[model samples]
Target: MLRPVVVGLDGSRESLTAADWAAREALRRGLPLRLVHAADAPAAGGSDLPELSAPRHWARRILRDAMDQINERYPRLYLSAEQIARPAAEALVSAGGAGELLVLGSRAFSGFGGFLAGSVALQTVTRVERPVVLVRADQTVEDEHTPDPEGRPSADTPYRAVVVGVDAVRPAEQVLAFAFESAALRSTPLRAVYAWRLPMVRAVAEAGAHQTEEAAARRALTAALAPWREKFPTVEVVEQAEEGHPAQRLLSAAQDAGLLAVGRPIRPARLGAHTGPVAHAVMHHVRCPVAIVPHE
Candidate 1:
């Protein structure tokens, strides 16, 4: 069963946007929305006297006001929030044990930033067990300043498109199902993308051999997805097969997407240098909101 979608709020603009998205989403799904804020206790500053940071106290109070605003603005949304005396990621991870989805807002941590996501957003995406959603709060506000390239309001979505990234993994079925369900709800088309890179590039000898192998690869990919297509016949399946890095291809496909869904293994091994390559890449580049699916 899908559990509640939990969002992390650190009283930043990003968190607020994340909260707004989560609220609307939870209401649409008839699911409860859990808003979590983690406030760190003031550290001792050399002198023995424990300094009571007024800002810390005020932060907790701000959460109450924020929650109230959500309650008032989204009357139909089921919303609740909690504050912990720990880091944001830890608090959210603990909450994720029972969460169906975890969401965060991307911030620019680099003081001299040109482009990139903040540490907290990136770390949460890598470490969280459940599927996580990252919102680009920086763009949400800045987008207002620039003229719309699409020549329409950024929020002017007559409909939302559901996009999913699939590879050769068995877990992809879960991701596809989640995307189909979402598309069904929104009555939008479900675009399925399967990115590939020939593992044995050096094996091919002839120039025409590459085309032959590419056709075979595409055929095999379609055969794998046939079962799901048979099941959700109404779902408009837009298949894409490209030769490039999995992450890069997936992100490119998601650029015009409303929601991008990817699957996670049931048991994720402890993240070493870089957990899984595909998901890591998607977390960094995909501009739209991302939904992660976890297997039972």
Candidate 2:
């Protein structure tokens, strides 16, 4: 059986945006879409509030409304809805195991306040084995495509390049494969960005030594991506090595990207936060959709 694209919905505008993004992705991948809503368990003695007393009913309504809107937009798409009686993060992480891709919504923060991914979004991304895409509340299809020459909207605009952050010293195969495959699927270029910085002790060593270090970094990145480039011959690959912070460079590279892919080291829930600082930063700040891929 083909795995379906799953999305967590909570009747919030952010979640609705995620559903929209997931629907398009499902259609692109020729997979079914599953919408999941987690209804929190009622209070110890059962509260007097109607919503708390009938949590399932409220969840069903949220799902129904979402299903209706998605159905109207994609009548031919196969869609299903379910309600789980558990905490939102737990429900999403469990559902993610059986999904090809799990999508969640995050509200965009204004100015430099940073994003609010919520506890559920952060926890789910850290724990899920599959790739989890976080879509901003205001993200739209047009944002994923390149603008026309006249700077006007057009349906025929091609998608922007797919950007992937790589740690040359410890490249993740899963992350590289996902980036290459996504670029191939969209028939777009892949930008592999690897950022490095000279240690403080080595900053004033020598000019020639600095050049050698830079060369070595570039070679490492090339070697790391060689196999993936062969695997995806049709994908145009652009390798970039910059001397700076990884997160800062990635943020710069993602300015014009359609999707940014980053790797999260797989860590057991008991070990606390698993997402690295770079992945966490990009997920919250990148304007385009962000894909958090888990790898061992």
Candidate 3:
């Protein structure tokens, strides 16, 4: 099983923005966003305080309050929060797991105000095993518009250039639907890269032969997506059959991509409840933020 989605919220403006982004995404993907608030609880009561009196237990309560306030605004969002005695980034990193997408809002950590980029966000994004999205507090999302060769708006983001990894197993159809819609939203181009390697076939020697395989792969991919393409005629499509590891091909193709979408296939024996080879590698190596559509 892929792990769950989690977002870190520390009651800061950036954290709140992160919460908003996470909530909206969870709603879109029909998944729950685990909102977390790690607080600093005093290890021991101050010596000055009278021993007979009870110390205030506020850390856990504070977390609950923040979570409640968030849920009130996004009532439909399924969220849960708890307090723990650890650094906020560490708390978030600990929550990372299979299928989980970690999101953080950007801002400086010093004296109450600065730019959106923060050390915590950077650390989480760079180190996590699953996908991490570092969103600016002021990040305003807009629909993608493909520009023509002359740099003009094309067909409302053409649903073109949608890419998906196909291994004929585990990844659900819902992932495909998301890829199609995302491409349609951008009206850009559509391409799929399925990397494969045979034990005896040396790939470096057959770059030309791989071109033919790429063509055939395109046909197979088209056949699979035939219904969707017929339904949305404006969407252009392409496919790549590369002779290498699946993960490397995906990372290479996604380097200049607007959006990279992948499926978290069912847990494999070796992968241990994680996204398959391609998605896992992309999550770490790609410079672009990826949309990990869990094969739910």
Best by lDDT: 2
lDDT of 3 by residue, 1-296 (tens): 43455777766676676677677666656677786766545458645555423323444554566677768877887776656557766776677543357776665324532234456654554345565654445433321224557766564443224466655323357566666665665565676666666444734666666566656665665566676677657767666766678777787786556556776644444744444566656654554435655554
Separate clash counts for every candidate: 0, 0, 13
Cα displacement (Å) at residue 129, model 2: 1.3
> Each prediction's Cα lDDT score?
0.69, 0.89, 0.59
Q: Residue 229: error of model 3 in Å?
A: 2.4
Q: Rank candidates by lDDT, best first.
A: 2, 1, 3
Q: Candidate 2, which ten residues in sequence have the lowest lDDT sum?
A: 107-116
List of clashing residue pairs for candidate 1 = none
Model 3 C-alpha lDDT versus the unseen true structure: 0.59
Error of 2 at 19 (Å): 0.7
* Number of the candidate with higher lDDT, 2 or 3: 2
Which runs of model 3 end up more than 4 angstroms from their true locations?
A: 1-163, 168-172, 185-188, 202-212, 231-234, 268-271
